[model samples]
Target chain A: MPRIDGPIAFRGGGFAPSDRTWAAVATLVGVVALWQAGASAGVIPTLFLPAPVSIARALWALTVSGELWKNLSVSLMRLAVGWIVGTVFGIGLGLAVGLWSVLRSPGMALVSALFPIPKIALVPLFIIWFGIGEGSKLVTLAFGVFFPTVIATAGGVDNVPRGLIRMGQSFGLSHTAIIRKIVLPAALPAILSGFRVTSSIAIVLLVAAEMIGAERGIGAFVLSAGNLYDTDNLLAGIVVLSVLGLLVSWVIGRLERALLGWR
Target chain B: MTDGLRLTVDGVGHRYGGLQVLHGISLTAEPGEVMVLVGPSGCGKSTLLGIMGGMLAPSEGAVRCAGDVPPDCLNALTYVFQDFSLLPWRTVAGNVALVLEDRLSRTACAARVAEVLALTGLTDFATAWPRQLSGGMRQRVGIARALAVRPACLLLDEPLSALDAQTRDLLLEEFASLITAAGTTTVYVTHNLAEAVRLGHQIVVLSRRPGQVRDVVRVDRPLAERRAADPDLMALEQRLWRMIRDDAAVAERERIDASD
Candidate 1:
């Protein structure tokens, strides 16, 4: 085994862990500097677009007002509920199609036709059926994410090497046993990719559904602020959305590494 | 080992599209014996091994497993594939554990995995992924997978063919010793005559594609009868080669003449 003499750090980053930490700090400052310049030079309008400082002030005020957390919690709840339901159905449908050729062609046809229809287009119909509450929002987001996850997962399952499954069965593994142990593990990397992709889709849909109709959520807050012509608060919501996206993507990356630890 | 295992191939044949890949191939691997199938490339030797392993069903006839192990266990018959069929997703230990997953209990599985990992000198590498290993280590993992199963009979589909000469010798030495320790009834398929000579208790030579059993060339000589100095094994090699190479020439001529 190779000895871990030191930390695995990037080339020419120096030996200090603090150097890496300081670099991140510098990057954030640079972004704030760029935003300040853009706002001051009128590349961004003062009334409609807040400077970095003003957006931060808006964020601080929103936090103090408890509006940011309330909105964030609602949006996150919708995303989680939608993503889970979507992923469960997607994986189940994917396996059904992959295991049977008769299912494969019909299943693919369904995905192709249904996948392209803009999910948000159903909002008015959803509003009519379920009212402008969590139900409609969750269903819309779930519908948006499910097909892509199903398609990706099914492709992964279909492409699992026949030799491994045969190995499992030759040892007298029952059909269900083979699926639970061998097939799932074999398809994990691809399935993880499906979940990752679906979560992002869920995030996008969550924001859209909120913007369409909701009392509190980053999206709804931004949209309402726009109606009230509170541009700085609207920009503050945009910043919040971008930060959430970055965090989600980073966390997903870490989860991928941990799940594929064997690989 | 329950008198070893016997393979009774009764006139098995297979056709693909308009072409026959194997036809009327018949041979018997007796108990406590090593039957080496030797032929040139594309000679249907591998296809025949596939039939014996039940990876491929014969289009015309059935493969019978007599003595120990059920006929369907022929389906259970595992092969050390010609290409070293090690799964890239599994670690060295995981690949080795694959075959034994059913036979052993959870604790036994872990213990057996540890045993084989040490036996294969993969103890330090139990956590290392298959893709991280060298070709030699990957092939060792393949061998370990077969061994871990503790199958009634073993199949080797020219596993060492992809290896270099030096590594091949070292591996062959280890393989022979290891299988001898386990006392497996093995069917080894190889194009290399020296490997067949070194490993087989009995060598079965095959003709080209749509292969038939040309002859069963027996190496009655014990491991001790193999004289390192006399080039005596060279005689066995030549004998096996003559039987296979001529058939190969005839098969190629028939192919060219057919193409014309």
Candidate 2:
């Protein structure tokens, strides 16, 4: 028999990774500090890339003058209307496509054909059709959000276990009851994850649509600031957009925790 | 106890696409009796169970249920699945309440859910999620959900096949008592010989693919009185093993040959 070495070297410790919130916070803080230090020493040009402190000052000025709320409110309204409209219609059509054979092929065909086309590229076309107003901007965001929401909802519905549905049927559950009780809850985790994606898409399209034609949104403000060589406000507007994304992500996380606590 | 329903599967056969899975199988689950279907893998016992429960339409014949359904019975035929099939999003009581929700008033639904949870010894875990439970506990939830409807008949498809041996043994004793207490006719499909001798009043053995009934063995002893270590049951288990041993071996070899 071969003698083994003391405590045979442990090799199985690592493939499992866990979240460290502190590490994420520390990394973000470290990068901002490094950028601020470089900007103060003139190692990085402030004209092109405004310092974090300068962006903060610009934001404060905008807040005091009430201009930030003016632009932000308009953008928030557009996001709310566009995303809600798109989501309602998307989930409806997605459920139809998932449940029925007649709609599955045609709906998926349309999604596959249109999902890859960039919504930014169609902004000019929407402006032409909807007359360069809120109509055009809302349409752009809604259109961008529609296809992915459809795909996500349909996929979620498709992935529900057939056994669960069969069990529901065996219990003599009504057709609508099976879909509402068994199908919906089973598909929820996927639909919630899809919300995460579509929310980010809505923000991106909001900015693009505003940059093209709107006069009051943050995207328009950022573009105007860039045109006037006001790097401070430009960076400030971008910061607001990033912060908005973070806020939306945090809301979705809370929604998942509440709805999927069983999982 | 509710009067058990008589489930008759008359000349039932089923084919999936181009393949015939079950051929000319006929059996009857009598009122208030356990009918155990035992066979080798690929014998389509699950398919037969599905057909018996009206979950699947057999290609050749029909299934009929004839008996007085209890006034409070929400569903006449209920299934306890091999995988438990409890919704992960619903609590233990909520899963039991699912079939009752549409049929009963809100208070009545809650009452029935509470009754089944207590019956299954799961009253303490009523608010727990399915994922939090062990395999045995999850299947208890499955059985509880089935019982919540006051089902006249139960179609259990290898309910203990997914559990470990110790859990299977423990649940086997519980299942015998549960079935006897409910007095509901049951059609249980499994490959385990011991389970057949232990729970089955009538054990129906089947041949391999395109399965047909090979033999029917009757045990006159009451389910609760039967023990796993009884000499009679052990002898019966050995007899059943001998009956299906050649078929199981041939089916296994066919699997290997097809894969090769």
Candidate 3:
């Protein structure tokens, strides 16, 4: 093969640069346009699903009345608390399981057994055990986030090269020094990726728990609107959840760039 | 401060469960000398080096690092790994600073790091991450890190084996001069006879498994004079090769049989 210093021309057809933002905006706008046209033409019933304009109006009304903010704040607070609790314990236990052979077998077995059970199914049990309040909802979200974090952290630590550890030993590094300097940095990329998954799981469980037994949250508002056949308000609440997901993914993207730039 | 430091492997033997790797291996690397252990594949050279570096305990006999170490010195021995073992998250300067962080003052550590980086010709790439460097450059960083510790003895296990042939040849010369400049007792293991003749003050040849000493050839000539083209060095390489040729063939056949 001949070597060239400048940018290589692509002969094989694969990835190419294009107007990605324009394409995304155009698709979304086209869908809303089609929906509006269908509703105006009376082809789609308004009771089952509202037009985009009606949903936007409902969203604007909620925003101005401060109803949206009230529900959003409560939901965000729950997510923050539950996710933090799960993450701290998950990382702590995961490091233990990964570093010590004694903990590996039992920890792995428990994670495997519990991780597969549907977390939403446990909400009723949580309510019974912790009482029907913030405790149950918080526990629900924490349970959802915990198992995946443990799995990810342990896997990350396991993937660190044995050769690097040996090198640390030969250089006369203490156990604590080796773990802090070598093992943690090597496992960081994997752990950060785990955060992305656990965050999504938290959002899912948060909504589920809120919908089941809560007076103030996006999930509660959406549930009430659906029962009253208020399609515009329901769709508006759904849009809020979608936007929250987008914001979260954007934050994670920035974190990846900041932390794992060496890769 | 590094004077009178010697690494002695006295009757060191090792066995991995049912497989015996080395037996009754004895050698001493004196102050400011490089001892090269050369043999065929699976001759247990690396295992012996591991024992000497205090990374492993021999099943029989002992490894002794005998000499006076300064009261201020934190590490007596350091190793250069064959795999370049550079942490991907750390920059070149960060990797070299790791060993010095515990023992030296912040200002002193920076000075030591700069000196070693300059010695390895890596001062230009101090802030660059390991992933951005080529294999040879990364190994240079590894060497710089090892030298930064100011160890009385250095152990290298086939440190140039992973590089491409041309890069290996180039770095081998750099390594020879760097070792001479450091003037620390060193034990290096390699399968290549040419590397053995070029770098070793004393070249030790070991036979096939249950590896025992076959010969110890002392090269009293200067490192610069031990060139590939020089007749004397060529003769030494040939002599080393002849000692291992029959055992290497036998080891290869046994390996094939074991695999089957």
Candidate 4:
């Protein structure tokens, strides 16, 4: 230290960055505006990629004709039923694998072996087994959703602090009580994050299954539009799918805020 | 008040696989007395505590509990952990209420939770989460949870060791009064000599690993009357430190060597 005449310069402030909601919204709006301008000036071929305004007009026409809800409702039902059934079974088995020594190794082994096989690849096999009906479509989505949920739940359970479990035992808590109260809440964050992954998987598998077979649904509508070379309707269908994803992620964000506010 | 339980450690010895940690440790914690276990870092005091609390099984010997249990005691023996194991997901009141839910009715449980929160001066922070608390406040929640059970015997595993010196000093005074008032037999494990001299009715000094009893110093003074700055207590603290100084140095060296 030579002299203490000057104030020290601060050097520890750049690594931490805060999120800006307005910046994200502005970027999306800017991209759409640029795309619309290019389409109007005929600088880009609308035949290949429809302008955002054309996609919006197609969506409006579909909504007015009731075709949007008609196909969307069917897809939503498949997504809900398949995702719920998969989640219930996955969570049950995951808890078993987490809590019991008898199941941990065998359960994890099966999950590791089966989780890597893409569910989209099983669509043709499912169609042959369950027929080209709702049965096959549902099975495809559920199968895709199941493995990830199990892995997430098990991983969550594994990460719960041992000291907390020991504290529960010391208090003479019953095995069921400990599992329900202590283990479940501790693992909820991981399970919730797993839900985020599984939900996306469910959606992707739903679209793929519908494209392979099925007479109605958003995926069927999109595929038929693409076959007819109707780029506007195809992009409209894609927009609907994107909105569905955003709505789902928004719901999960709310759920996290409500449940994990303590964090 | 109902008589606190007597906990007896009969020829207690523990080994972790090939490593011998504690050996031939026989001692009795008389009803309603504070029995402090003091030793070097690797002296297996916490292992011994776990064995006594029935959380871990010792390699040899047994622990026996005798004497009356209060009717309201939900758990006969409860532990206050070194890390203040409050559930991060639950509020302070909710964490305290965990042990009571299965045993008590809804209203009764709520009442007991309120009572303990008040006892620990945490009534204002009952709805706060553990992550929202300071280290000292978190341990207060731990103590509140332990007291909520109305335990016949309390097993505190270095409960104050995680706090800052000022907080530890402040909480130590509170601990003495609370223990004296409850008259619950306590087995407190720590390496702090000042804590042992201040709180222990019988302070058990242990040697290095393969820990055996080196000495048991008896303090006849009442806990409420004991002070940290008292000349007698200071002398007692110095004496206890002298007993463990060589063993502690050796244990520290062994730890560094093992790490290398």
* Top-lDDT structure, candidate number: 4
Clashing pairs in 4: none
Whole-model lDDT per candidate: 0.80, 0.92, 0.90, 0.93
| Candidates in descending TM-score order | 4, 2, 3, 1
lDDT (Cα, tens digit) per residue for candidate 1, span B10-76: 9999887778878888888776567898886677887888888887778988888867653223223
Runs in model 2 lying further than 4 Å from the true structure: A1-5, B1-3
DockQ of 4: 0.91
Error of 4 at A1 (Å): 12
Better of 1 and 2 by DockQ: 2
TM-score of 3: 0.94
TM-score of each: 0.88, 0.97, 0.94, 0.98
Query: What is the C-alpha lDDT profile of model 3 across A1-263, one tens digit per residue?
Result: 99779887889985886679988999999999999999999998988888888999999999999999999999999989999999888888788888999999999999999999999999999999999899999999988888998998899999999999888888888999998988888888888899999999999999899999999998899999989988899999999999988888899889999988988
Tell me how many residue pairs clash in candidate 2.
0
Task: Encode model 1's per-residue lDDT on A16-72: one tens digit a residue.
Answer: 654487789999999889879999898978886679888889999999999899999
Candidate 1 at B12: error in angstroms? 0.2
Supply candidate 1's per-residue lDDT for A204. 78
Question: Model 2 over residues A73-175: C-alpha lDDT tens digits?
Answer: 9999999999998898888888888889999999999999999999999999999999899999999988988888889899999999998998888888999
Candidate 2 Cα deviation (angstroms), residue B176: 0.8
DockQ of all candidate complexes: 0.27, 0.90, 0.79, 0.91
